[model samples]
Target chain A: MASVARKNLFEDIPRFLVAQAGIMFAVSLVTIQTGILNGFSRSTSALIDDSEVDIWVSAEEMVNLQLTLPIPAATVSEIHAMDGVEQAEAFISRTTTWRSPTGDIAPVQMIGFDPASRMFRMGQLTEGAIANLQEPYTVIPDRANLGALGLDEVGQSASINSLPVTITGFTRGTQSIASSAYVFASLRTANAYLNSGLTTTSNCQLEGDRLTCSNMFERDASDIALDPPRALRGSDGITFVMVKAQPGQDLNVLSRRIEAEFDGMVAHTQTELSTLTRNYWVGSTGIGFVLGLGAGVGVVVGVVIVSQILYASVVDHMKEFGTLKAMGASDWMIYRIIIEQALWMAILGYIPSIALCGGLGWWTFATQGITILITPGTAVVVLGITVGMCVVSALFAIQKVTHVDPAIVFKA
Target chain B: MVVSSLQSPVTYPIHSLPAPAASSSYPVEHQPRRAAIAADHLNMVFRSGGGSYPALSDVQLRVPSGIVQLLMGPSGSGKTTLLSILAGILTPTDGAVHLLGEDITQMSRRELARFRLENIGFIFQGFNLFPALTAAENVELALKTKGVSRRFARKEALDLLEQVGLADKAKQLPKNLSGGQKQRVAIARALASDPPLIMADEPTAALDSHSGHAVIDLLCRLAKERDRTVLMVTHDPRIIDVADRVLYLEDGKLTQTPQS
Candidate 1:
């Protein structure tokens, strides 16, 4: 059977290669699209996945990390006091404007965490230390976006929401799928930038028996502080309270406890949070559907092209097959021969396709800084799909062969 | 004269046959000739969109083992149909065909395929060699289909090709071979399985007189040397002298013609 398949493919090299080209193009398309989408989904949740905390406490109804609303930083203390809780620290993420060295404004996702607590660690750094973030007005920017953020060197200074900050270090591979540059800073520095212009005021308006106090108002130099607001201020109102479970404590149990005990807040384990965030970006934005549709189209095109090619080959070899049948070759033997041909095509087509796709992935990443991951698992899965595609196509050709009458060989 | 159609189990008298030719390689007393193929009331009807056409009606045949039997008929005379029925390649609409003493018409398709693989060798008019395979490889494939090991099949294929005087062209593909050489390769393939019964349909139809006579001579010699039953269909009168018996058909009826 192997000899037969090899001979047939070699006999018409041009036609065989044309068939291989169709399969290869389809496979490469599918691999590239799926690889990029997978890379994007992973990047969307990289921050949460890379964090050191075991559980995340965010405002209720927070769909994704990027859209999280600020929760009262006081929640950290409450979470710290709960049973099975080891430690809790305030974590903040705000998409704020950065004033680049060129004085151009660009959006940066500012991540602020406690420098003293090990609840969250900075991303992979190419330069400087994580302790440097403790310095006042200091930050670490992703190296991939140095040009976009206009931070030429480690000591270069920039501004986040008009607050001057020095680029004390650089992080690598922290670029988000949103194309927003990431800046890491201390909790205090982020709070100063986040709550710069807003002040608390007790301007009460009365109507009927209800009295409403409007404390949020813009501050001006002429206005005097009438009284301090009752609620905590500044860094006390942070985006999230990241918590770690004590040794021997179950994260799911701790998360459920926090969710049940706290009001106006939700608790999720690290994996849950990452999945939720990834799903929000992928499912809510319809990116999953679009990418899936692309892969589906590739598979369908591959099936059609391979089926047509195989069918044509079977037609051309109809006399040969009929001769084999008349020569006492069983139906199973003929079927095996055709299936072997299909398997050969799949393997031969996939080898070059994976190589080409790997090159394309590298080129795309090097040029655009958009990661396209072609992992070993991805290769295995793509190969499986390729084999399946060819086998299914061969079935159509097998049907044609099975119906051929061996007696036809006797005809003129 | 019209021969009576076989409607019942009737015995055929073996003693009525003439003495074996002196040139026969096998002596008559040493071999007990048995019927290699027998058809009883074989009827074949082809159905189509418009109506059904009867190709063979109430036809019967018997070819003795260890002899070269030739079947002669005009075009559309149902010779190929009868050969296909006897080879278990097709089942008649009614009646039974016994090849090598088993009722092949009663066998399932899968069973019939296996039966034919082990018992019959077929040579087609078109020579139907796989275009991509070399001449020896084509013959080797038939041997492999009969459960011969790869190495042994290759050796046997070469030997069979040598028997048919095609050993020199063993490495050449069918496309590189001439029409007569292709037919010889087909003959080698048929003999590869070493089946007890051999069937050929118009084996010399596409060849010139010299090639046709050569092919017929090879078929006759190979059959007589091995004492294997050979049934061939031919329209050429030039090869009729080589047959041990000649069966003639007209309008699907069979009559045994005395050899000149």
Candidate 2:
């Protein structure tokens, strides 16, 4: 009967198999592509690549790595001149609302950096160009943000903090998590609007294994003893310091040393801080759970579609099962027939699904500036899930077949 | 009905029947193991909805090896029910049915299936051939179920198909075969495993006279010449003359009639 089953399978190919193949193909595409996205998008940030870095300095106990920390300018200069140091620059980051010309307001990350810094040039722009840091009234936004801002070409004006800034050049990596627009501006301009024009020259500087502060930014500036405190105690300056270690330098060790030298400080590398930020977004903010919930919904949809197709096939061929049983074919033999049928369908479906998903993933990464990479292991997992779903659906038909008595073959 | 003669049956020795001095004959000894099927006071009950329904009761018969026994009755006369029991496809509610010396009523469901696979063959009224398989492939399925390898099973299936006069249509699907040809393929399938007993449920019902006679003749030849046992359930009088014995079933009771 096995031989007959094989021949029958070949003859039954076109009608039942085509439907099954279509469903499996869809499942393969969705699950595999989602898996690829989950695996490759490091830190799950909308705009970031996996790279090595050493230390990140933030305010003590600040959970938001990107948006926290208000270090004085004196500490920035002192960190650059510290032992085994390379360079130090002031950094400012905050989340602000962008009010479009159409009066539409959306949440955005306003990143403040030095015009002459390398961190500003770290990401590649997908559209327009990066902002000129030396320019006081210009900003660069992510391409997605460019669309939201209705700013297509250069010289388009958008309001950040109600301050009009020209869209000098569109840049990539502007999203924080899920297409939240990111804007880059000068630290000087950012601080001006932050405190009602009480702008002060920051006294933070780096020198000889220590980042010391003038303590002018503190409420009790007199009582606190600061190493290398400015001779002129009354000085105001930028509120944060961002230090970049030289290539091949250990910033984790340097960060530890800086914290020991200057108490009540936080320091981390770019990689550590990015991971920390992503964890904050996905874990505390509940966005990661939302994306995961979407993937689970995709799996449920795949199962329902695949099962319906298999059930219809089973209903069509019920008499054949009765005949086989009357001819002395056992229940296991019939089960093999159904499972083999489903197995073939799954294999056929997986081929086109993988291809379609690969194309979609490529297109998504290319157009969105999001990295989604599909690995061989992830492909295997998707194949297993597809076939597993097929088998689960086939089990219903098999149960029906087993319950069929040979007597039915002759009765009708 | 000569029931008394059967009850007081006498045993015979070799050479009891007159034979020419020039003719030779094989022994016709009843080996007791020669009882291919025996049912003593069998009963079958089906329960459904609110109550139990009796499908068969007090059925008793014995069919010896190397003879064709025909079971005849009207529709719902328990002919199929009896056939189901004798073929080990269903268990009797009471009494015992022994096929080749093993009481099938006591066998487990799995055991009964294995016994049926190894010892019994069935030909359904519709021929019940898998529509997608060719004639030879259908026969091959029977042999394959008996654990024959694909290579040897195909060769044997081809030989069986040729014996049933279907070698020319070996590769044709059931949809393309005539009613008679399809039944011939079914017969070939029933004979594939060389089982000791063959049961046919109206095997010749759908065939024309010529085809019907050919089918009965093939079954008779296999019985008398090959020592195979055959039991056919049918209401066709045309086949009654070919049987070594006949049993009539009415309301699930068996009545034996001996030929003069």
Name the top lDDT candidate. 1
Q: Per-residue lDDT tens digits of candidate 1, residues B74-138?
A: 88888998888888888889877888888888888888888888888888788988888999999
lDDT of 2 by residue, A1-412 (tens): 3444345446667755666555655575456546544633442443333222245566676675455556665677677788866777766666667877666787766666676666434366655544464466567776645656666777777666555666667665445444356777667655532432222456878998899876433222321221121221113344345666777777778888888877777776676666776677656766456656665665666566656666666565676677667666778888887887777667777787778777776776567655455678768877887788778867877777778777765664
Query: For model 1 chain B, where is the 10-residue window of minimal lDDT?
Result: B1-10
The estimated TM-scores of all candidates read: 0.84, 0.76
Residue A62, model 1, lDDT: 86
Task: Please write out the lDDT profile of model 2 over residues B154-176, one tens digit for every residue.
Answer: 89999988988889999999999
Q: In candidate 1, what are the lDDT values of residues A1-412, reduced to their tens digit?
A: 2289778877898999899999998899789878988878887888888888899999996878878777887788888999999898888888889998889999998888877777686668889998887787788988778878987799998777666778899877667776478888888777766664456778898989999887766654422332221233534678788998899998888888898999888998889989998888888778878888898898899999999988999999898998788766888888988888989899999999999999888877655657777899989999999999999999999999999998888898
- Name the lDDT value of residue B163 in candidate 2: 85
Docking class for model 1 is acceptable
